[model samples]
Target: MDQHIAEAIGRPDLIHLDERLVCLRFETMKVVSALAAVRHLLDTGAVRRGDTLLDSSSGIYAYALALACHRYGMRCHIVGSTTVDRTLRTQLAVLGATLEQMEPCSDLKLDQKRRVERIHEILLHHPEYHWMRQYHDDIHYLGYRTVADRILRAVGTRSLTVVGGVGSGASTGALARHLRTAGPGADDVELVGVQPYGSVTFGAEHVTDPEIIIAGIGSSIPFGNVTHELYDTLHWVSFDAALVGSVDLLRRHAVFAGLSTGAAYLAARHERARSPERTVLFVAADTGHRYADTVHARHEEAADITGLAPQEVSDLSELALPWSRMHWNRAPAPAPAPRA
Candidate 1:
């Protein structure tokens, strides 16, 4: 009954993992945003069907945008990060998307910066290309409204906690915003965002994780769309902790999800333990196939999930270690990092 593949894959499967824990799993989560964003653009005359839509992506958004372009009869051009794995690159190519990938770069911030710079450079040559600013634009939030409605219908907003990685702020931020405005128990929904130690979004850039900075969940630069006030709490999860969570998720619940989902799951479990009265639902943004070699392969190295607990911190200055949790208290965005 779906009009397109994006519509089919964009629809998530809500799995009740436990009595109070739920998993909203998506094959490719950003398809929801890309589809709706493109539709809105077309409807509003912001872009036409044959136009080339461009954006910078680490991985997921490239595929999402490509699929959206394919569905809407548009061209997709992605300024890909160094992290754009071969799997995603091939998928994007097969879907008729042009990928301008960056050279090998170990530094996440530099890689992202280079991609953004390249996007601008391309725009200079091709002014006709419409740049889909996934990190900065609010148009990405419009798609999640339908997702919020589905969640509200399945699980009422009463004593609910929405947990997910704080990517571009479009996912968790939009979900919490739409759910809060839905009805009577609107205020009951709490948003708990998961972040990486290197992400500057919540002032975590000061702390560096020895392991890989889980891409997609965190950003080294400031994200314009991230409304810091939407989050009630924040969890900074390291790659090692998330590895355990991802392995445990597949081992226990059989949900094969990406690294970010693992991080969100780790935080969601903590929230559920702290508030048994509240139902915790975490977003599993994508499948585990992409992470099979990177994360899931080293299952032996993963610490026991049962023994892992985040160090609670009252302030960002107190943040430390493999895991840390802080009550953001709907605070304003932190000051942006000084550019070199």
Candidate 2:
């Protein structure tokens, strides 16, 4: 009976091939770990009853927060963007959570500042609501640390190259902190953060390009959860590279992942090339089924490889962008190093 039950549970099959490569699938474990963390937080009085959890997520995190909050008998208020999947919205509504759609503030790119302003407005209007800001909350690290711990234990090594994209920077930052504090087995792990070249806020300031299509990661404003000191290295990837990675994952690994995952994968590949003999790990943030129309659309095949093909569409004159093109890729120059 135990054997039958184990088979039914469907654990990820991990293959350890030599010291250089260790393939570990902790996706299912991650969800369970996140839920367990939520339960622990509720039980330990870190998250009290009747507190309204406010999350600024496009979809996945919103659903996780709603489901967890519902299970714990806590109210959830999701400040969702217009770009969020309708199916996710329906699920949240069914869970009895209130969803407020922030009016698009002259930006096709979901502006984080606008979302934050709406959240502030909601708080001001409803003083009874206790915003469980996931970005800055310490408990957000609880589940993320589990992932890093699992990687360290499974590989049986201290020197690891961890690569992942930053949404709110909660998971990425937490994993970095955990790896830094690990015992003898994980003393020299390096955490690298990847972001879209269009919206590079955490690593290095990049001008937000209006033409770029940002899917999962990258924030319009600097999130409270990310600290520049925590990251060992940062790489900015173009949307074209991310798209190629996404297509490659779908074709080769049969892994349907979102654009953010693609961005991270491409960055990981670059990092892997730098340290070819070392073990590199990347996070598959979410499934790509949600992006069937946008990223996976057959119509975008030609435009997707535009950076490589010169014949691809390049007329921005016909494209309508909400923000001025002047601000695109016009980031302020990096400050000079201090003299010793």
Q: Which of the numbered candidates is closest to the native, going by highest TM-score?
A: 1
Off by over 4 Å in 1: 337-340
Please, what's the RMSD in Å of model 1?
1.2
Structural similarity to truth (TM-score) of each candidate: 0.98, 0.76
The digit string of per-residue lDDT tens for model 2 on 295-317 reads 66642462332232111112222
Clashes of each: 0, 2
Best by lDDT: 1
Distance from true location, Cα of 294 in model 2, Å: 1.8
Model 1 lDDT on a 0 to 1 scale: 0.94
- State the displacement of the C-alpha of residue 249, model 2, in Å, after optimal TM-score superposition: 1.1
